[model samples]
Target: MDQLTPVVPDDNKQAYAVTEVTPEDAGDVQVDVHTHLRDGVQRKMEQRHIQMIALAGTLGTGLFLSSGKTIAHGGPAGSVLSYILTGSIAYCMLTCVGEMAVYAPISGGYIHYIERWLHPAIGFAVGWQVCIQYCLFLPSEIIAANILISFWDQAFPKARQAGYMLILMAFAALINYFGVRWFGESEFVFALIKIALVVGLIIGGIVLDLGGGPNHDRIGFRYWKDPGAFAPYHEDSGFGYFLGFFTNLLQAAGSFAGIESIAFTAAEVKNPRVALSKAIRRLFWRIAIFYVVLVFVVGLLVPYNDPNLLQSTGTAASSPFVIAFNRAGVKVLPSIINAAILTSAFSAGSSLMYSVSRMLYGLALRGFAPRFVAKTTKQGLPVVALSIVACFFGLSFMSLGDGASTVLNWLSNLNALLVLYSPSVGFKLTHVSIGYITWMMIGVTYLRFKKGIEAQGIDRTAWRYYNRFQPWPAYWVIFWSSIVLIFSGWEVFTKGHWSAQDFVIDYITIPIFLVLAGGFWIVKRPRWLKAHELDMFGNIPKDEDVECDEPAPKTWFGKVINFLFT
Candidate 1:
């Protein structure tokens, strides 16, 4: 039997068209007219688009709104430390993803990688796990949007707020319905606005710290000294300080939530090998400048013990930045920052729509979902998959009943937990969070990929994109992430602090993943591929056939803009 199965065309489905294979390739493979990409999607997402979409998805409410919570928990110095550590882990994991993505540029990203390197059942499970993650994630963005919008007026009516959310939902659907290029372009603009906001906030933070605000109160690390670097948690002891730091570390994981999504856009991005490499290299800087530096500024701006920091106003009033500004007698900037936060939330929701639909399309392509889900429009938009995912936006309306902040916490907790549990090790061992699981999966998958290359004698030097640092980053992720996961829920197990909700939130994805992967394994009993048997070439796009139509900018201004994005 041919290793590659032909895609059976449906007259009602305009997603894929059949293509004739060359004489040499005829018996061994089947080809599609859209073999350059997948599910009839076009390679229109430029390098800038890929970079900015990741930025748009990641730099949302976590930094603008929730970083205050981090400061309240971990104090100034402790929060900075926590963010730095999480940033390192994110950097290492992204490099592992980049190495694989640049090589194959597959549509499904890590899900497909897990299937090819390990077992199809594992991929099936992880794919749906992430798909479900985004389903929950979409509503959280809207919930956050409501919080930011309410900053303008504390008396904002709830019914009107819900209506506003629906409008944002409709906006996201329209952009995605148009096509990936439209989604990419929209994200590019949104990301730039977010980038400008962070940069401006950072510079303004320095000015405020140096007594440049109207109040002329030089804060120059006064909060750090007053709070004494680390805030105590539960009890005033070394153990308490440790718990504070750990709590901040977990929250930092939430801030870095969508970092790995760049891999998911691999197939649709123009010049996947080159574009992904550039974006991956820049990923570290993005984390460093936006998250780490901005978080450091946050600590300087507000004291850990400030009463306003804990006030869940569901508005910029609770943001450390706005709180700092209010104290410094600068009133107008809070409104401006609130506006940026609102846009950030909207941008995040729109990006989630694009990501979730693409994931569903990928699932259908791999036969993990119904084939009809893969159907696309003439323009290559995955209309069917998108429509199904769009229904999930209605879940945002849950905010109307529970209150925006309450629903936001529930969704945020689930998403933050998911970061630890991205994908796990063969469903064997126990005790980990969503973020830890994500790191472990990427590490383990990369390790398996390396082993396969060695066992199969595949030459690494010939690959278009290669990371010289091999198994060490993978090892670093596995060892540290395991340690974090094991101790992540320690607070709950401590004296008089056990909460069922906390415990469940920390470890819930384990059972959920087990049910999904194990159920599939029991039913299908999919064969695990041996290293030598891994079909590395069959799914890879032919470099010669991939058209690099994106032209270099000629004008000096265009060149500068291109350089900045790249």
Candidate 2:
């Protein structure tokens, strides 16, 4: 009976590995070598799969549909600048994540890094933050899809919307159950479809702006002059315009939320070192070109004050894409764009499910959650974790009764505190739309353990990956993220702008995060792991043991796809 129990150890490195002591003929307590115990996830995602995971996880309703709202609020120029600013923040975060993830190459990605490198309590907090964030996020996507369908048929039934969400969630869960390869391949296709939509829209927008389409009416940035490149905010003056720009910047930041998700699959991706670095290298340009540039061009093609831009039509038809095409006299593209948007939203949900399950599995591995959640099938699927995460998808049904915007509001509150961008759709909850996200990031990255890695006798040069500017980006993430957290909600304090809803969205998560982290501090009273005490090698794969598991693509097209995309 004693053989089946695990031994608590003072050393974290020993505590991890999740080694169970089993007594056999020797009647001794020893670590078992079960395959499931070795590594709880499959390394089936290839380089291309990593790229698509990042892309498919992002590139959804936010950029495709909601940029219209962003442009209306910030104006075209303001919106682009905001995107660049936010994209830069995302770049810093992703690179830092890449540097750590490649060196660690763990399933939980940053969550594992937080627990081992910083403090377990903070890891506990972040784990809950991420799980709850995606739980709300997955349903928000479902609700966004429902809103999209209703735009097509404004009277779309609530029951039908709930049914659609359930079907979408079930399908996403099914795809995840097949394991990483299945998820990756499906996401690869999903990413391609999303890229095609954005590219096609850009080309079509260019044509319409230049008056090259069949109707031949030159737009040529006329909207920028009329509605102007700067939209007035709470006031018509310079400061008000700045407010508009800042708000739009926050919204734009929201759009880029899950850019770091590729790291979540680091444990599952083949050749995580190369795969991760490659994904990080190519990501910024895509954000700038596909998101910022496309939003810029959308602003150019359509006037921001167009009635539809202000209205939350809840469908891709309501997207600047459909609005611009139709205004330019293109009739048929809206339906096509809407269809693509629906798929994009669905893709986001799929990615969210995968990330949430894996993150939870990681948490379980760290003993933060039920150990059963860490269990996996022979295929390396965390079935118990997936089942638990999938159950939260029912929250999307909140939209059917209360409305999508309302659910988005509550979800948005938490997400904003963390600078979470839901691909593009808002994470609404209980009629609240959260804003602000940098301080939360600061909390996560401030106690980062790079210096500890050096102390662990690991050679910095030998590390598979390193951020170009080692400590600077980490420093920036710490400083700027905190500033965003503090100032993002400042508008509510203005004399005329105070509102209960605004305060909730702007600041609610701050206290919740503090409470979680603080509560842990109170009970456990854990100190931040100092440099020498960091667990550099805890349950992590040795550098020499790391090797690429994916085979080279065989077909000519496959090779080209891998080369270009990966």
Please give the range of 10 consecutive residues that has the lowest summed lDDT in model 2.
26-35
- For residues 1-566, write the lDDT of model 2, one tens digit per residue: 21222245431112223333322221221122211233457677777888776654578787777788778878888888888877777777777787778776777777777767777777778778768778767777777877777757767677777777778878888898888899898898888888898889888888888989667988887888897998887773448778877777567765776666677887887777778777877777887788877988888887767778765666766688788777767788877888888888888888888888888888887777777778888677889989988888888777766777887776665565653446546333222122234224533553356777666665666765666577776766666667666677778877777888667766666677777878888987877657987655544555444475557799999889977876
lDDT of 2: 0.71
Tens-digit lDDT string for candidate 1 (450-547): 87788877777677767788788888878878778777778778878788977876667777677878998999897877776665566466665454
Which sections of candidate 2 miss by over 4 Å? 1-38, 151-155, 158-163, 236-238, 398-447
The TM-scores, one per candidate, come to 0.90, 0.87
Best by lDDT: 1
